[model samples]
Target: MTEPTRLGGFLRKSGAFLVVGGAAFVVDAVAFNLLAFGIDGHGPLYDMPLVAKVIAIVVATVVTYVGNRYWTFGTRALQRKFSRYVIFVALNIAAIGIQLGCLAFSRYVLGFEGILADNIAGTFIGQALATAFRFVTYDRWVFPDDHESSARTAIESA
Candidate 1:
C-alpha cells in the first residue's frame, strides 16, 4: 500500500504557511510601530494601541490568507466551494479577537511596558495561540479537501 499523501502535503503546506506568516507578521509589526510612533507619536498608553493593532492584523491577515490559500492548500481547495473562503474569513475574525485580547491584557494587567515592546510581546503570544486554532479549523473545516479519508476508506476496503 502507498503511504498517505495527506501527511506530506499537509506538512509542506503548513510549513509554507508558517514561513509566509512570519514575513507578514514582521511587515505588520513594522507598519504598526511606524504608525504608532511616527504618525501619532504616542506611547503604549496614549491611545494608539488599538489603531496600531488593527492595522497590523489587517496587513498580516491579508498576507496569511493569500499564502495559505495558494501555497498551503493550493488551487484545488479554492475550486471546491467559494463559501469556504467566507467561513475562513469568519474564523480569522475570531483569531483577531484572540490576538487583540492577549495584547490588551499583557499591556494593561501585566504592564508589559513600552508601545513597541508591549505590542510585540503581546502579539507574539496571542498570535501563537491563534495560529494553533487556525491550523485545526483550516485543516478540518476551511480547506476540507485533503482527500485523505476516502483514500483510507478505499485502502481498507481493498
Candidate 2:
C-alpha cells in the first residue's frame, strides 16, 4: 500500500478501536459512580473506593472484551483465541491495579478523597496511561491476526 493508504488504514482501525473503547468507558464510569456513591443511601458492599473500582473494572472488562473481540479486532474464533483472551483479561487486571494505585495515592498519600479526586486519579490519569498500554497489547498480543493485511485492505479500499 502507498503511504497515504497505510495512514488512512491505520486511522480507520484506530477509530474503530476508539468507538469500542468509548462505549466500554461509559459502562465503567456509570458503574463506578453507582457502586461508589449509591442512589439515595450509602453504597452497597465495600464502601471503599478501591472496592468500587474493582467492581467497575470487572463489569467494564466484560464489555470491553466482547466489544474488542467482535467489533474492534474481529476475532471470531473464540475457541482458538480463548487462551489469548485470558491473557488479555490478565493485562486488564494489571491496568486496574494502575488505576487503583492512582486512586489510592490521591486519597491516602495526597490526603484527597471523595468523588472528584477519585475521578481525576483513576479515570483521567490512570486510564490514559492504561489506554496506551492496552492499545499496544491488544494490537501486538491479544489479537494476533495472521491475515492482518485483510483488515488493512478493507480499510484502504474504503
Candidate 3:
C-alpha cells in the first residue's frame, strides 16, 4: 500500500477500535454502577462490593474481548486464543485492582464524598496502561501467526 493508503487504513482501523473501546467502557461503567450500588434492577450489594465488582468486570471484559478479537483485530474465534485471553484478563485484573484501590483510598483514606471521581480517574489511567499491554500481547502472541498477508495464507501454510 502507498503511504497515504496505509495511513488511511490505520486510521480506519483505529476508528473501529475507538468505537469498540467506547462500547466496552460503557459496559464496564454500567455494570459496575448497577451491580455495586444495586442500581437498575440489581439489589443493593453494598456489603459485597468486591464480589459485585468482580462480576461486573468479568462481564465487561467478555464484551471487550469478543469485540476486539472479532472486529478490531479481525480474528476468528479460536479455543487456544481464548486461553491466551485468560492470561490477558489476568493482567487486566491488576488494572482493576489499581482502579478499586484508588477508589477505596480516595473515599476512605482521603475522605472524598464519593469515589466516582477518583474511580473514574484511576480506571482511566489503568485502562490506558492495561490496554497497551493487551494490544501488544494480543498482536504478538494471542492471535495465530500470519506470515502471509492473509489469514488464508497462514491457514494454507499450516
Candidate 4:
C-alpha cells in the first residue's frame, strides 16, 4: 500500500476503535448505574460505587475485547493473539484504576460527594485521559500490525 493509503487505513481503524469504545462506554455506564442504583431501589453495590465500577468495567471490557480483536485490529490469529489480549486486559484494568482514583479523590478527599461530581471526575475527565493513553498504547503495544513480523513469517515459510 502507498503511504497515504496506509495512513488512511490507520485513521479508519482509529475511528472504528473510537466507535467501539463509545459503545463499550455506554455498556460500562449503564451497568454501573444499574448496579449502584437498582430499578426499584438501591442495589447491593449502592454504597460501593467503586466496586460497581469494577464490575461494569469487566463487562464492558469483554465487549471491547471482541470488538477490538475482530473489528478494530482485525486479528484473525486468535491463538497467537490470546496473550496480547491478556496483556490488553491487564493494561485496561490499570486504566480503570485511573478513573477510580479520580472518583475517589473527588468524592472522598475533596468532599465533592454528588452524582454530578462522580460523573465528571470518573466518566468524563478520567475516561478522556485514559482513552488517549489507551489509543496510543494499544496501537503500539497491544495490537501492533507489525510488517516486520509478517515479512519474517513469510520468509520462514518460504
Native-referenced Cα lDDT, model 3: 0.61
* Candidate 3, residue 155: how far the Cα is off, in Å: 18
lDDT of 2 by residue, 30-82 (tens): 78778876775356733588888888888887887787778877843333656
Please give, for residues 38-117, the per-residue lDDT of candidate 1 as tens digits: 55666352466766777778888888877877777674433467788789889988988888888778777777656656
Q: How accurate locally is residue 158 in candidate 1, as Cα lDDT from 0 to 100?
A: 100
Candidates in order, TM-scores: namely 0.77, 0.83, 0.67, 0.83
Instruction: Estimate the TM-score for candidate 4.
Output: 0.83
Could you give candidate 3's per-residue lDDT for residues 1-158 as a string of tens digits? 59999798667656766777677767776676676555544447555555555666677777777787788767434455457766766666775675566556655677653336433543455455555665666655555445333666767899
Record all residue pairs in model 3 with backbone atoms less than 3 Å apart, i.e. clashing: none
Q: Could you give the candidate ranking by lDDT, starting with the highest?
A: 4, 2, 1, 3
* Global lDDT of model 2: 0.78
Alpha-carbon shift of residue 150 in model 1 (angstroms): 7.7
Q: Whose TM-score is higher: candidate 2's or candidate 3's?
A: 2
